[model samples]
Target: MTALHDKAKGKVNPVVAVGVEVDDAGNLDDVVLYRQQAPHTYKQVKYTVDSRSPLDTSYLTGPSKNGGPSILRKVADAWVALTRDGAPVELALVTNRASSPADQLLAGRDARTMLLMPAAAEQTRRSERGRLRATWAQATNLTEPQLLMLLNVLQFDTARDLRHLEETTSLLMLVNGLRGDHQAVRSGADWVAEQARYGHRKIDLEMIETAVRDQELRTGPARSVLSVATLKPDPLKTQAVHVLDWVDRFDGDDAFSKRRPRAPFTWQQLQADVEDIPHHLGAVPQVALTGSLRQATAFLIGATLRMVTNVDLAVTQRGQLWESAADYDQATHPILAEHSLGIGEDLALAVEVATPMTDDVLVFLRTQQVPVDRLVVLQPPRGAKDNAISTPAAAVALTVGLRDQARRSAKGHPRIHLFLAGPMGLSLLLGHRWNRVAPTTVYEEIRHSVQYEAAFTINA
Candidate 1:
């Protein structure tokens, strides 16, 4: 009999069991046996038996494989050794006529009864496949939007099959092609406004209406909407829909009719501005410079000048990083712009701009998953050392250390190059990480004159 079957029977036969344990009830519970320990000439004579019972009783039968009669004889001998004068205490192995070979044969026969039942095997197969698909979806880069759409479709459906559901969800996602960010809407509006500049009679009436309604909802209605459509005659009108009748009347796409026109500066202009720094700084050396000190000096010189002289400078708060670029301008304009950089990419210095807070630039950069080789904050030059370095290098070192420490604490290891440069700082302050140490020039002064320019290579 199998060990499990023997354990279930509470019968520990020494000749057939290898190891054994008994429960508190003195019934055999578990067993392992010396299956072929005995020589072929006396195989049955040298077998072992062991068992444990649910009652915590233990029973171990020595190798006594001489046959059923021999096992019976050993049990009788053990029983005699433990019991005397009809005391009836449970300790020794005991044999009764009811626990014969017929009982063992019956248990063996009934074990296969459940195994022969139908559908159990098929159910297990289906459950395993389901578990595998769930694990795959979680491990893979399945997007939240895809998952949400799947859930949405599933919310109302007669066909709840998994294959059909996944396909349908994917189709819906492709059809949508992802919604545009607030920045995109703003850009589109600006584009529409520019298109209106051509004095074309065409207008995206729906877009204008949406924009107008949104603007009215945000600011007071008189600025955006023609009038409020109210259901109640009372002054305390609670139910109202903002109406933008004037939006459809615009037949032009120019700056006058559109909300926001083309960007004041083009990409070419920005790139030119970025490159013109060194040219403006001039060949005259303000002080001896090399390495990061030189880079930091150049960056600060350019950033500082800009911040001081430029009046149209925008200063976005630290929280703008969490928003879309379009929403960023709406929230705070002229100083800073914010947009997502995507997974695994750190935020890029898309536009060189000073934020509202001092650490805002550093904090935003470090939040990126990509490695940052250096952090150079360019502020407009000020009379009071607009570019002052907290010397002894401790403050700069602390800032760098804190940034790295935060990254490490979050388990996202990234190596960062840091520099703190103000009016009094030098390029060597940037250490070995500064790639360019060009001579300062007038262009540096002009570029740094704006408060919005950050100095760092984006890919770097």
Candidate 2:
């Protein structure tokens, strides 16, 4: 598929051919992307239907079945042999398996290049990245420098499930003026397999074109996908037509850990970027959002891309799809229990869905001497907990109820200080329905601390 995509794009010199099963003794000889002037990329494809067990450091360093060499060991031996000639080459491990949740080392890998990011490598010796470097060096029988060098050229193309890969291949075929149906896909696969079986190790653009013509493939219309992300989504949906990447502005050490933007200017830049999406994707009725974003940021995005704009927004949360335009039973959903403090001129509203944050909000307000006469606390009827609101209907109902509560509670109040502790979906839903409310100031919790900071204010 890579070869076909490159050929269709008229990529010169760098990639001229692709090889399969070219070297029996080479560890990364399964599939090779041959480049004329640049480093050639050799890939080892590993597919597994088992979704329960993920690839971890233990699996990589442990012996394979029948006590064969470990996965890392084989790759290291291959790297040593290939680099002996002073030739710059790249190696990749393409797998459908996912990385382990507890695997710290593999967690530092960049989603796009699959290499350990520079930020990860530069961490302290006691950090997860450092431990990965040390462990892999010892396991591969290579010095730290050697291991680092190998890592620089090694890539991990993981989580490429067969279905997604097939879909991507079909899309690529269609975009390249070839038949994109399942039968066409099977034909393409058969053609490649026949070439390999016939001892034709290398295939060039002409061969690919001839095979396509002989197969009598058809072409279809083009399609596009728009992805908006603050943090890169793993196994980034290959279907995206354009990706607005803001990961560079963030520390790339660990995806699970909490970290702030690289600079204060990042937020402003993000706002500007979000504002430009409509112009960039003119007439596109829908956009898909995937990222690890702050509640404030999510709300801001929703407020910017309101329903009146005629662009639908969709996000995947907890394996379920939530869309701004999706229908819901507003009357049959979880009801929010609201607690109101003493009446005052200004309002302090704290919405806690994932966990209880009312106590902390109260402390922050009192300690900081925030001038507010009324403080409203809204939470689930039972209490706050994760997955408290499971369905989209519940989420929508809660957001609407919260909005109405705020308006009613702040009837005399001119300003509302908002502190939210909930899922991103709820935040976005609230922002989308935010209207006729008092001017609100949102607060963000400082990382690794109990304190809060004013992130931004919104008036809608």
Candidate 3:
């Protein structure tokens, strides 16, 4: 579907042919996409009905269930054979399984490139890196350098379920002026299966077009869903026909021990991911957002898909749905009570919606010696507490009031230090309405501590 989408979008040297079950001496030869004057991508698709098991380093390097070569060894051997002709090739392991949080080496794999990150690669003597190098070399029976070389071209395309893939393919068909209905999707799959059965290993663009025309598939509109999660999967994901998973990039065995992503870079990566949603879904008009995101991340997502964009958004907050296009009675909603402190060049804005955080924010400001000329606290009418703003209207109202306060109070300040202690929903609403303020620095509170760290500085 990705290849088809790229071709429809007129990608340079797009895939011209695809082969299924080709007689290649490699496990990755199940599916191969041939591009014009570019490296061909060989993919191995693995699907497990059990979602409990995740893909980890141990599983990848462990002996196959049938007692042949390990998964890693098969791919490594394939790489050696394919690259023998001095041609560049790409190998992919496409699976529905999630990545294991317990695997530190797997955690170092960059989500975008599917390659070992430079930072992670540099730590060769470190526990995870060293172990990865040793384990991979031993499993593949290859030298360290050879193992690294193979890994450079290896891609892990994980966390995509069958339903998601089907929906994506249907949507891609619609985008490419083909039928996108359920029947069309089933027909497409059946057609591929029939071709494979007949030993028609190679399929060209003409064959795909002919099949689509012969099947008489019709195009239709499609909606896309984006799921942004941290601690767990979002409940609203089940409501979507298909979902794009944007789980956290943190590495750890569990939520309590999860390692926070490095500031700025990880934040930027997340921003890039959110920004790419439109392109990924071929500019679907409506995008439903579901997630268990942190306040900062939620805010970032909202800011990236702000009100001015062509895409409309509907987000699930605390089990209630909030539509960006919904109309609300601004007068009936609760307004924030603001408190001001002594003035300075940099202003501190503390938005306390779920709980009180003024004291902690003040402590962090003073301890960190953040240059603050003034401080402004925006709280509920009574005060910050759990479930301060219950309704979507109230959430939007509070966000509007907070935005107004920030803009009015930040007139003389060059930068605003934003400290938020609130529901993720409120933060997202606030971010959607955030605009025309001074360069702002958003802070994330270090768990179990009063200290706050700068997570993202939004200059726009």
Top model number, TM-score: 2
Q: Candidate 3 on 132-218: residue-level lDDT in tens?
A: 778888999999778778878888878889887876565455434455567778999999999999999988888876886688864
The lDDT per prediction is 0.26, 0.72, 0.71
Candidate 1's C-alpha runs over 4 A off are: 1-262, 266-268, 287-342, 345-392, 395-459
- Better structure of 1 and 3 per lDDT: 3
Which residue pairs show collisions in model 3?
Answer: 179-218, 343-373, 344-373, 344-374
* Residue lDDT tens for model 1, 309-415: 32111111110111000121111111222333343422222212222233444454445333433333333222114222233242234223322332332233132
Candidate 2 lDDT, tens digit per residue, 1-460? 5555454434454467888888742788888888776578888888877877788888789888899988899999988887787989889989999887677777878876688655446776788878877888889999888888888998888888988787656655654446666788889998989999999998887898788778887442222344555555534334454567666676546654433456654556766776676677667566555556778767776776666677666555654445666666663223444444554467898888898887788777777778788677777655679978787667766777777877777788889898888888778777777778888887767654547877667775
Count clashing residue pairs in model 2: 1
**Candidate 3: lDDT over CA atoms?**
0.71
Which is the winner by lDDT between candidate 1 and candidate 2?
Answer: 2
TM for candidate 3 is: 0.53
Candidate 1 lands at a TM-score of 0.17
